[model samples]
Target chain A: MADRPGSDQVTTLDTPIRLDYHFSAGAAATPYLRGLAEGKFVGQRCPVCRKVYIPPRGSCPTDGVATEGAEVLADKGTVTTYCVVNVPFAGQSIEIPYICAQVLLDGADISFMSLIQEIPADQVRMGLRVEAVWVPPEERGPTLASVEYFRPNGEPDADYDSYKAYL
Target chain B: MPAAPAPRQGRRPVAVVSFAQAPNVRRDTAHNEVELLLPVIGEVLGNLGITKDDIGFICSGSTDYLIGGPFSFVAALDAVGVWPPKSESHVEMDAAWALYEAWVRLQEGDVDTALVYGFGKSSMGDLGKILALQLDPYVMAPLWPDPVSLAALQARALLDHGLATERDFAEVAARSRRSALDNPKAQVAYDRSADDLLGEDYVVAPLRRHALPPLTDGAAAVMLAAGDRAFELCERPAWITGIDHRVETHALGARDLTSSPSTAKAAEVAGVSAGPVEVVELHAPFAPQELVLCRALGLPVDPTGAGSTSVNPSGGPLAANALMAGGLIRIGEAAARIIDGRVSRVVAHATSGPVLQQNLVAVLEGA
Candidate 1:
């Protein structure tokens, strides 16, 4: 054995932190979620500026005031913008060549992101009329997943001038 | 033509006009961060008889790690309306840093008023373990040493080095809790004696339960105005006469835990020694750290005693440790004393990282 007592060596220790969290939604989403549980789209309009917001983001970005008066919205809406997902990556849940569109619901001031289906991805254009295809009532509860996807609503495309401001 | 205002070298006076805080609680189940901050922001602004429109720049301090979401501060903006797009910024550190940014912005003379706010909910996750993520990711964070154990090492250093006694820590906790009786927002407060507190079980060696801060969910907001606008807003504004912040080496082994040189350096630059301190509010999460901070700030180890300056009159962090907001709340508490005319001059210190790796010092005075 070596007589020298001191040696330069790095000792490594393994330490891991596993933390669990209970996620709670903000106050504004509580009511909106209740409507989802009931198979309805609930949104609010800003009190200062009567801009309706489906899936209201607690407040109006333009006015910066809490949205007021829960207003149930229609399942059908117009696509103000859209993007075709053609790139493939790991954990790709959906098949390639799907469409992700920003749908501006009727009576809503802002657009919310949603998937478009039942039509060709290239056919999913701005100003496309789409309706929420909901899961069976038994499978639905307080979640956006309640709606399977927005498909063709068999309605004529609205003129771009009608939803130009949203773009 | 007039020599460009002589190229002002000194700081432009910025006064903290109002401060409001939500009650610190172990759990705020009913309200999220936005809802918790809304009332505090309202009260802070309403205290000055003003609104969001009155603030020129809005700065906030918070970390997304606590919220488990990216860009959580964006949603929190709803509490303080940013409509018409106010000049706003945010920091991932405590709100005291946000106040620092606002102070620097005020120096530009473009923003006459600033609103600084911070909010956090430690009860949402394992605050102890989560804090480890802030350690040196390469070596220290991998060890997952929670904040309490790290602070205990510092406390043990104090004890071993004869810097302080266990009774000193108890006294700090006792005095802090007693002071918290007056602080309505404090999460924990009692009239227990120091000796009794000394008998409590140790959360970590040399650090008793009393010495450790109670985890809290809280939010606080403060308003600052530059020059004459401060006079119009608050009758007795706590003017920030001097402010500075410093950080130590990131490697835990590279610095001395027994003494916080960064805190002392910050105190020096912040002109804490220049004035007669009447109130000193410190963001010391543990009791021993309070002694370290007091000594670093050039105050007595027992700063809580009935001395010339009252230390932690708001119970300090031993009462409520709400992470990102703790430091800013210390500054606000000190400024509140000055605003209330209880003190002419005060020193407020805020610390971040493990065992006071970073420190911020500010001197507020009534003008």
Candidate 2:
């Protein structure tokens, strides 16, 4: 057994454990979330690199340039890769064995992390076609949860090597 | 091509010339990490005949969560007496990574010598549970699987693959503890045999208490100087020829835990296989991990051979594992051997995250 310094302290704990955190409220995702409330999928494009980003970021990771000019995605994309989340976690809204996938919207350089639903877990695979399932027009909020989940598009599977790096 | 950035050319080339550490104990009530580090830092600096003021840069590796606090490294700076505000930086990863950052800063040409340190106090909290946070916070961390259980899973995978046995783990622990007896800084140093360790019960299945590193509270430091400045500072300078690091995917189930491909990739980039490695210091937190790392690095098993590298002459992490600082101490130990003229060339390694998810390797030589 590991040694506890205060072994004699069998008394009830006095201090209640409280979860307190300070998050960066200035996240660029805020406006994107606001866009989702209006039934719009917004993104930003880098002027220099000419790359479009979904769920707009403040700066590009590779070029380190500030993104500019918002653009709307077509609300459709191909599933790059995905996993069946057989396990659940705290603050998770969905049940176990749900699908989480990377969706690469057209004209975007990279894919974004999202949930997949309205599909069987065993059927999920790399390059499995998928599309966004937005929240009710009235219920959308300024968060990634604005989009409820992604559902299968019934398209042919993409080549294994094509999306391998995204995995 | 703009001269390929010129390798940060400067007036001097710096390398880690000397390193030292105190044994990692479970509970360090005898002294705080700062108190523990003061003397060791002084000892390492003294070997190079340099004072705190002589250091142009200072960097450290540590995590605040280890002690249930934030900005722990900031408090540790007091131990080094940075009243005048020296050029410094820190990493939330292992001290070995801090050393790498320092090496990169040295390449900038403004800094000639640097002081690197790492310390951890694992006795304060449930270290296993705290380390679990190092995993993917969304999916894996919620399971609350402690580090031991994950390592056990890896061990079982290795065992099932016919790569090693439970006996191999026992032998590594026994040898580590026994070898640690010669090291004054060792915490769990003992002269026990593999049979004695096998008698103990398993802490986590497939991982006996001996296979797991002792929860140690300790600190370490190393002094580095550039080419001519290093040569002028000591009779033999441990020149760092190459250093590189890589990280694996955060998902534990997604990776091949039985092999540390990150370590192998780091070794390749650090040029560990470029020439003969006379000595090696591997940062394996678990006994079986040492075996896995050895195979990954392509190092020989024997300790006595021309081509065979002596693994963990300072007993490595299995003897006294201080979470944040263990990796940096590996570099310090390997460099110390060069200062003692025991080896001409050596490789030092450090690891972080669950099951060696991230690895850093450095190749050092005596000049």
lDDT of 2 by residue, A1-167 (tens): 23457685443423222222222222345557678877777887766567777766444433433556778877877788777887778898788888878888766767988888888889787788777888787777767677888888777766767666555
The DockQ values of the predictions, listed in order, are 0.38, 0.01
lDDT of 1 at B191: 98
Candidate 2's residue-wise lDDT over B157-239, tens digit each? 98999888888888888878877888887877787778888899998989999889888888888887765677677777777
Q: Which regions in candidate 2 have their CA more than 4 angstroms from the true location?
A: A1-167, B1-13, B301-307
Prediction 2 global C-alpha lDDT: 0.76
Output the worst ten-in-a-row residue range by lDDT, candidate 1 chain B: B1-10
Q: How many clashes in each structure?
A: 0, 5
Task: Specify the highest-DockQ model's number.
Answer: 1
